[model samples]
Target: MRLKILGFTTLMALLAACGGGNGGTNPPPASNTLSGTVRLGNKASSAQIASSGRLLTSDQEEFVPGEVIVRFKPSLSVQSVSSLSVGGVSLQRVRALGLESTGLYRASTDTAGTLRLVQGLRARGDVLWAQPNFIQRALKTPNDEFYPYQWHYPAINLPQAWDIEDGTSSPVTVAVVDTGVLVQHPDFAGKLLPGYDFITDPRQSNDGDGRDANADDPGDEPGGDSSYHGSHVAGTIAAATNNGTGTAGISWGAKIVPVRVLGVGGGTLADIADGMLWAAGVSVAGIPANPNPAQILNMSLGGKGRCADSPAYQDVINQLLAKGIIVVVAAGNSNEDAANFRPASCSGVITVGATEFQNARARYSNFGPRIDLMAPGGDVQADLNNDNFADGVLSEHRNDAKNDYDYVFYNGTSMAAPHVAGVIALMKSKKPALTGAEALDILRRTAHPLDGTACTGQGPDSHPGSDCGAGLIDAFAALQALDGGGGTNPNPDFTLSLSPNSLVIPPGSSANTTLTVTRSGGFSDSLSLSLKGAPNGVTGSLNPSGNSATLTLNVAASVKPGSYALTLEAAGGGKTKTASLSLAVGTSAAKPTLEGAYVIACFYLGNDCDQIKSRIIQVKGQTSGPYSFGDLAAGDYLLFGWKDLDGDKDVSAGDYLGAYVENGQIALVRPSKSGLNFALEEVQGTGMLLDQVQHALRSLRSR
Candidate 1:
């Protein structure tokens, strides 16, 4: 599943999706007795959110309405920017940041106008790329919960591993990039860092605001079956253990960063990317830098399609990897090729598959070469262990059904991924500077052979999954591989990576990225760096202060025009590491005048014009070219666009349905003339058609 555009289809059942089963057991009595809202499927109501406030069929075309994300060529000047208008519709630039602050603008238009707006923008020469903000779903399988019954930890020898490196000191942060969490749960009290809510849509956030500092779980179910998904995933990684609490986590002292990405309707690809990047301390526009940067990111969410389909995700993931942040993802639960799902299929991530208490691949865990290792992700359908409940991994969650926060059991690659993330926490705690690549290599090298049935293949894929990673993870062995991780003496090693791997620089200009060093084993040595394969007349300089340095490159105006691959090498204490950088030297061609460009309401609204419903505004006016709508009553009115994407307007398919809008809805009134032709009040945003419109378009697209 490669994504050419940085987008995703609406997320489906996450790896931790709840099957139809009464979740086993309920939360034990809490010490506080006052837990707030949060969940993964254990007797759970898996309400994966999509946040699109529309009613469509199972196969709905959902995206933020009245908005389009456009990446303009860097050469285009801000002065050359203009509102693109087509068929009486116009798009106004709402906001821009990231992508090196290259004019990556989110444009806004009126409701029912996304289709026309996207077409207009795509037709322009200056626009490098354009796409609607697509939503992504959480990963986790639904299954019908107690901590004593948690066999997952011992299954991976975590009990012994704890004695070696329990993370009592030098605790690192593991970012849970999933649904929001319940900050008040006793098990998580003092265990959470100040995380952020990256959900940008109010409806999806269910918190009634855009991105903010609050990272608490508001519940994922709009109709009441909310799952505190993020909370569950967090507990598995850092639930307060031996505190007379419910369950024991892999890393008891590790801090959890709750970067909420999934909400009412799961999460958007845009929000997910931002959340992951922010977790690693990358700057996201309109959001503060993360004070508690994570050493690892636990994404128990994903969607179908190739990883390449979403360049945004790939770019962000690369950034995280370059920062030495370990990323762990669920291998999906479709019982098929792990390569078929994203994030898991993406490179540089530790993709984990599920194994039951018996040490065999769980019935639903995806398999294939993409899997880095297997971990205990129980089978919730049957009580193979005779525990009197479902055979699942135990963890704490916000149990709304029990009207309290308590323990529950769930099973999926979602469960498996966190176990690895927790192990990473322990590793990083032992070696504060362990790089992501080093962590993966250690895990794979220390892994044990599969103990599950077949020992070779699982899932419904075509061939035997002999390539399902090295084998089951052995936590104790992994810690031992760290060599004195719990001891004062350790092997000394260091890693280097360059950020913004690719840079586009205009001739005679300069660009800067970052070079970071991660030193392990308490090694303290002076560092020196140099670059290879540089073009003539191009010079680079930086001062290494501590573990980071700013690498600035100046290209002589005489340099040739082309892309150059450069290698950055770092050396310290008789150890060396090499990283790559991409440099492009050229200026984009000038843009031609826009044809039939109709600038809409570009006045007072500014960027906020795209903040809400700028799409398909409602108003009735005279049949004139310029519609100030004189003599029109101030009463609210409905709009009907002449768009039937499928060429057949059918109400059942939600074709051209009047947008469900109110409260000073922006009005798009063409001349009251028989033919519709009027300048819009220029909205500044981007989005796909309403889900209703998308529902019909989906059919047309399939054909």
Candidate 2:
């Protein structure tokens, strides 16, 4: 995705960082041709590209097809693992970094097979999880640059990281899926991979061609010199460090795959999504497959939008996730909620936001729950270093007007994203199996928290995890975490689900499920429903009104003969609930279906056992104790009592903190014959997190 240039201020002084000079006198263009609303819309579109390389289209925001996730019971058996291969089908395993036995799979590219595989897998007693994956995406937010002098690297402790993992020992490549790069730039000398240009619309291509092998910067400015944005991003990722060059990159030994999907007038949803797929070595219909696939994709560009609206883009990202490619996106420079931006808010991405020289959230950097980590994007307005020049991310820039390359300071979440991508490259080099989800877990655990007003507040303001993300990216700590981390999971509500679960529809026929909601914790708040896995010619619609809705699917007569698996995800009440059902084309007895939503919740107790927090779960017919708990929060408890939910410090509705407490053990549960008695009055919890949990529990008690 491309963002029109935002105006920059002048104040060039000494380029101490790069041992260079000149900050320039010219100001950023007085005005931008691309409006904010339209540009944001474009970012959302880029993630889920339509086949047509157009900017606006009705079918751009759909979810990925032919995908599903299944959680198996704990201490898994070989028989269960081997069963992934259905009798007459092939199940491609994506990632397995969730819970102990959770697996993601591309059951079938065809709708029919997808359904059968899911149905068959769920039929197995060992599987424990299934659901839809949601996804969202933005650019460097802007500021002054001095070539080769990047302070952001030090902010994240890159020097220490380099000593531990310079990425030289392994062949690591990161895809810069943006405006393309300048091949001749010395910073990219030995690091450039032969990349592809996915911009099909010649008008946007600006090179008088479409879908060519050339992946060079043709420029994205309307009537000015090229911004060299991709080149800048590449420089940050793997610029030649200690090579006596213009600037040093984060992962010095990593390679760069400069894929171009944006041009003069920005990018389209389809072109960008397709470019990402192609970069990951996934085959696109008309384009040639990428021969040198990358381990990471750094998207320093994006737009504002909800993940739900861009299901198509979400689908592409889920595929990337399955392939274990770490997708890093800029949190955007909107200065608002990153959760509203595409890709950043989308599931499974490492969303990076920018911090200034003072280690505070950048004024323009978007902040919210969606941010995964923070990095130095720089500030051109404040010269805290007394360098006269604004402290911006310094990298390679081409001044076509002067016919020479220039190194300058620039600010934006865009700059921040590359910094993260570079770090991920280093991590991927060490742990070959590092998925985007795992990368985040490590980043969060090791990040240096931005507290003490530097970037700590609540909502619309700065707040760790929720706003500024896990804090400033720490290369050193992250590397340390790589040595220590493993598990990753769902991060959500009135729990909702659909069932009988699987229905078979014949050609030219239809099926329906009545949707229902399960309320808890006074989740009387409004609830809504949406769908993600239906294929073409299959019309899936839902009623927007009323507390209860119906999801009706109509299959056209010309539809292919096959089975389809559908998933329902309920996110609310501080929890994430998901379920799946199968759809097949067969002459099976039909029944009017009620899309039912239900839940069962529990927590593990005992200091020696792994304390699982509230998922508020349960299958319809599961037993109240071990059966409903499944492999979840399973462990030994010395006493019967209530789960503390939060640590003794706070009460928890979901998973943030605490556990079940029994007789003041802080967390435990004592089952009562009269249904079940939840004794919240005596449980002790302290802290803001607990306060919220207490309120939620109170609501549930009254209900």
Candidate 3:
């Protein structure tokens, strides 16, 4: 649980809203406009308006938000109403306001209205934004995202990469140790076995009066709030796919065991330690015995501290590994060296880092000697499609209140860690007898070297030494490496060399070089030549395939000049040999003019919603239509705007926002004339209110 200082005004307002009113002033029946936030012990609900001048008691069977209405009349002259009854069913009374004698209280058959009323009472009128839970939706593709299951000359494209292989009947169980899982999610419905909640705060672990399992604390948030993070993580590992709904996950066939350890903000090392033990099937005091033991444990959370090889933490991790369970942890997102984080940097567990779809290290990923493998964490800046702008995954977060079902795009090592875990599950499913070391070897050996860099102890380009273990993980290559024959060296000895050794080339210009190879151990066939290093906006290629290959490199006129190295490799006899050459490139003084409009579309909380016309901004000096700029230096830039498109002061989701540079250079297109059009999309739903309550309650206490 986390705690925050509630300002005096906010605190007074809450007290007055809940306690100041004396019974009988007979406040007018709460108005249909009656909207407020309700604090349940430590947890708070989203702000909602009473629909049809009525509210539903918590126990009503059909009260859905925006669908139902029920009203309560406090006893006259009563200090406060403590309870109320509806349809013969009694519920704890909520602080009532907005009563008018002439206003007739009417009840609607709609349950959504009642839910809205309850939400209003919980939020106290302040509505926060909401987004969809992405993690819950993305966990459908278990192996395809991490491992290539079959081998083909060029790799065959299948309708769905994640299809269950025949003859695989066994199912594996993996424990998700973080926030609690949404066992109720359609993807995980029946698959979520009973689990334990070790959160010390009673208010947060209570589980919202849902099903009774081994144990339940209100949750990490003091008042029974659930951390969507855990659910997101769990979804990444075992969300069912092909259900014709949301995103896909990695392990569609696997079962998830939710072990709630960190709550609200986070949990202590001790609680995490306990959670680990329980997750690994180890018997512990005070916890109900796990009826179903987990073979793999997915821990997507960690702290920044040197790995303390202390007997306590080590013993717990070691025991799990000894039992044949592979533990996966995230390489922290601090962007600092990974050596600073504990457990992740600790031995006995697989430490994973983030990479973009292109297999490049994520700009924010932590790098160090300890990182074992890299997986697709998606780049916020890289154009996922060739559309020319960065696009990636967007999921639900615990931030928004009003549209709690909405989701946003977030990039971090946290997203990368689970990809590795899901891949492990696929390997386990393929070869159930594979040991942890064997599985690690399969994953590491198959990784594609980033930019032709050697996979020895030395790191790839940009990252020298052991920073990026092996290189970028290649699902296709790893599966091929498992086939055995590829392991044999194709070429024994054939060295290729490049000239200019090192020289600068201007952008948009080509540099030609000759490759000379000396044959020794064997005769070389046509050599398959490839160029590995060049900065973004620069392109390089090898000409003439054979023992003697020619090299041609082009640096985009907009390329940012920088020092780089490329490796030229020769192959024959099932073996490969490589030689490196260095070069420097300078960017062009000219920038490509950019003028385009993008149709902004988005789905929030599983709903299609639009608020675009209000948010689009026109660049200064540029007309409302398409426009462009001339030459500009290579550097970072941003676009900014805020409902100001219409000169409005408030910045709402559909409100126009301008862009401003956060980091990096905009060289591919004209920086000066380049302009980005904004299209805003927002998700809608009430589920976000649940997230807010959890966050608030968690903020009120310490775990």
Steric overlap count per candidate: 66, 73, 109
Per-residue CA lDDT of model 1 for 329-445, tens digit only, reads 999887877886788889898999888877877778888868888888887777877869888888877667667887778888888899999999998999898988778877766
10 residues in a row with least lDDT, candidate 2: 33-42
Each prediction's TM-score against the native?
0.58, 0.52, 0.44
Best by TM-score: 1
Q: lDDT of all the models against the reference?
A: 0.63, 0.58, 0.45
Superposition-based RMSD of candidate 1 using all C-alpha atoms, in angstroms: 19.5
On the 0 to 100 scale, the lDDT of residue 243 in model 1 is 85
Who wins the lDDT comparison? 1
Q: Which 10-residue span in candidate 1 carries the lowest summed lDDT? A: 37-46
For model 2, residues 486-604, the per-residue Cα lDDT tens digits are 21212212446563354556668876665667442123455445566877777778874455567787888777766566675555544555656566554323321111111223222
Residue-by-residue lDDT tens digits, candidate 3, 474-495: 4444444445523222223445
The C-alpha stretches of model 2 lying farther than 4 A from their native spots are 1-138, 141-148, 456-465, 484-703
